[model samples]
Target: MTSTIRPSSVFLVSGGAKGITRECVIRIAQRHQCKFILLGRSAIVESEPDWAKDCFEESGLKKHIMEHLLSQGEKPTPMCVQKVFKKISSSREINNTLSRIKQAGGRAEYVSVDVTDALAVKEKVAPAVKRLGSITGVIHGAGNLADKLIEKKTEQDFETVYAAKVKGLENTLSYVDLNYLEYLVLFSSTAGFYGNIGQTDYAIANEILNKSAHLVKQKYPDCHVVAINWGPWESGMVSPELKKAFQERNIGIIPMEVGAQMLVNELDAANHTTAQVVVASPATPPARELDSKLRTYRIHRQLKLEDNPFFMDHVIAGYPVLPATCAMSWIINTCENLYPGYRLFSCTNFKVLKGIIFNEDLADEYILDLQEDSKNNDFNEITFSAKIWHKNLAKKNQYNFSGEFKLLREISPAPTYDFAKTPDGNKINENREVLIPNWEDNNFYQNGVGMLFHGLSFQGVKRFLTFGKERFTAECCWQGIEAKQQGQFPVQWFNPYAVDLSTHPLGIWLQHFYQESALPAQLDKYEQFARIPCNKDFYVSGKIKSKTDINLIVDFVIHDLEGKVFVRLFGSKFVRWFY
Candidate 1:
């Protein structure tokens, strides 16, 4: 709260050229008629405070009086300088700021210097002592008050406010010369004492400066160091809404000058005893006297709730885990034909969850779901048949598994679509099998149309449908001419054909699509898994038809604990079963 720093007799006012700090500087300087050094971010070499001009412009101003007094003119008071600054602030255009100052008869000058740099302050600011003949006080009024919460605050945001205030204060204290510096006035705020709601971090940073106020005062005995806890004032920082709001509270608005004057008034007493003072338009109530419910900053500390052991247990065990799994299931199985809210794989959530049996210590809140799903009710027992492998399961050593199949307790609804190929007029070709040439373009387009146009039938894959148009398509059968998928009765037109599918991608891509995502394990007896077209078009079976006839990949999803998924599949026209 030290308003000014005195060197010899002149007082160095930090941020003395603008804002509430300006008035504080002028009032103290003119009152004592002591020379002053006003500081700003920019340089006075380019401009000087308008008071310097008005002093030389008007007839009765200070400079005019000094020169003409002996010869006989009257002397104007310090009020002559105040008019210049007021007009500049109200000027409609920035270009007229200096002109308005001149019209009102004053001068404005600034010396280039970054106030935050201590070395710069010691050089540019301390030298003002000799230039002005003496320095009396310094007001550390240059600071900021931005609003941001801790959670949202970033590194740059916190640095901006800290640099202007904390750095500015550190710069000022470096020059507390007893013979020259008499007062140290810092424009602190209530935020420093009681952390602001949205500015907890900012307030904590300011407290670092506040806590050292006494030490600063003790170090500089001649310098009166005052810490002002400023409240909402009608300044650039105050919103229009706040101005109107505070007006209704019957509290008086301090003209920036009054707030400045408060600092100046306290500067005179920068002694060993009086180190801190709060400057606010409306005094706050005693600490801890306010209602706890009304306090927003103490939310974490003021939490109140009844002890619910079950709720606590749920939190520890992760209550929303099941819900998250259910969401994923719904997204992956959107086309499942179930009731509005009920889904097919939805029950799978309970199945896997049964694996994680909570101890007896599991909370009642979690136990509430026991009756919800009868299958999940008995958490003590949840197991499925392990996968068994044969000595030579597949042509490859790595790919194979055997599972004891479990029959469904009840059959679900029938499928939504039917396929009929034998009739006279049907979309399906009368031939049970069809094969395109190994280099046929028609084969690629028909199979890749879904992949290239709307997108892949699986996980939205964009494949080489055109293959650079350099004859991208082809057809190759898995078996000999006589080994094509055969029908129950020989119909001349009802023969399945083969298209060259060699270039097709054979890989795994996790996708959400209805159908058997993979060929039935790997055919152990045959070197490769075979996809044979059945006589019945759309009958549900382990057999998959992937040629020009059905236009499908080895797509299937086994409804078992062990899952094998695939899409964009390829196989042969003739495949045999291992009976």
Candidate 2:
């Protein structure tokens, strides 16, 4: 972890004299007491004019200017009054920024140089670096906006917005020596990353800055080069009408203090891998394009015992086998990542074709292949098929897992189905003997104490509420260690440990009624109505739908304390496991 800024660091900042950038400059000066060479296009008045010197307020200055115009025999047009007001106000703002930085125990100097002019930038910045010392950091925040659709925009309109960001960055970096630089912060906009409707030129210019940041970071591996894609801030740029519209649409506006602190935090952070990032509230509109092109993606993975300590708890018959729920987690998490704005609604036809057993002859790596099947743009739904396999010289396709996943743009409402009570409203069949485990040991899944073989991590059955021929319910809690619990994979949408416990009732019923233990074979469907509750007591109810000599099919439902169904596993088939 390296400190990015020091008291002796010299930062050349563009567009740092006003607006959000000025706040960041003031904060940096306060924290590090570093010197700043602030650049801007506006030229400030060294002193107020004689007649307007007495006026401090904006309205008073305007009145004096109007009276002075009348005495000089000139027309005081509305446009003339506004033009003078802007100059005086801008000069006052620049002077205040400089004074604030100095008050924060930092030295500062203002340079009126247009960043878009490469020769002028070189002429102004080279002399400042020579006198102050070698440059250590650069904050490029200069930008202009020409908000218009491409059809209505003129060529000059595009250049006016594009020159300030793209050309300005190129001109500023040309004279600085990158070998000794420690930080490079580029102020980009969310309109560039997630394109806005009327900001084509601005988006294009800022995106170039983003790509340039990545390129520079690769060359200077030690420098913290980050391009922040900031959303709209509470500043003079956002008009009242625009602010009202943003509120109506539930979009977020960044406050001035918060946005400034984010810049300082980014510089102070020790992470060097993050080169481009977005800094915005969660309400920022994401880029959603209904791309229907068919695509196939492949990702490779390798599993080892040393990397996955949690697998030690799941050993069956002297070997650690990958759990079916964890395998499903891989497909669900990968699909969600491939499509940014969609979540896994349900997974169907999920089967464990071959369980990945951790043995001496395990393959070096496995490949996960995913292919898009269909997409419905109207409903914002998509379907894809995925399989985990390893190439073998003798075999053609050795798939370890396969499933079809459906993703939805929004989560479905929590289902209202009671799994606790029987549908026919019949009392429990008490004639059938109830099988209960000893409370002292709580060893339902221990190696020899119980029929099933599972270690402490998978032992989630705390106590049984009811056990009968037709239905059985049990209280369960997540007892597994959270750190690196999913073996080689990580938990994403839902906890696999909790999901694994939901199926335990099915296995328990088999051992109680038929004197046999079963393992999950395949799943007919898994629908997530709501998120599973953690750090609290939840219940799982399993009702036997059908049974045969070879297998048993059951329906398992997990619900919260209020008896609202959160997850439903329909037609879960399990085959008897013989020891």
Winner by TM-score: 2
Point out the worst 10-residue segment of candidate 1 by lDDT: 295-304
Model 2: per-residue Cα lDDT over 1-579, one tens digit each: 364577789999999999989999999998889989999999999888888776779888999889888988989998888788888889999999999999999888889999999989888877777777788899999988778889999999999999999999988888688887888999998778877767899989989989999999998988889999998899946778767756744568899988888888888887768899998643333326668787899989888888877788778788988888888887788888777667788889888888888886467888889999998889888898999998655656688888899988777788776554332212323432233543234446654432346666666776566677888777788755766665556655656768887887666667656778777888999988777766677888888898888888988889875678878898888887887
Q: Give the TM-score of candidate 1.
A: 0.37
Candidate 2 total steric clashes: 0
RMSD of each: 29.6, 9.1
lDDT of 1 by residue, 1-579 (tens): 434333235545566566566555556654444455566664222354444453433444445434433344434445543454334332212223234333433332233456678888788765555555544555666665557667887888787778777887777667665555655566666667754556665576567667667777777665566667676666746678656645644335677767656655665543436666666543222222112121111000110112211112112123311111221222222211111112222122111112111344222221110111122212221112212111222332221122111112122332232222222211212332222233142233343221111111111111221111111211122232222211111211111111112212221110112211221222111111112222211111122334233233242211111111111122322212111
Q: Quote model 2's TM-score.
A: 0.61
Find the candidate with the highest lDDT and give its number: 2
Q: Output the worst ten-in-a-row residue range by lDDT, candidate 2.
A: 424-433
Candidate 1's displacement at residue 55, Å, is 22
Name the lDDT value of residue 172 in candidate 1: 69
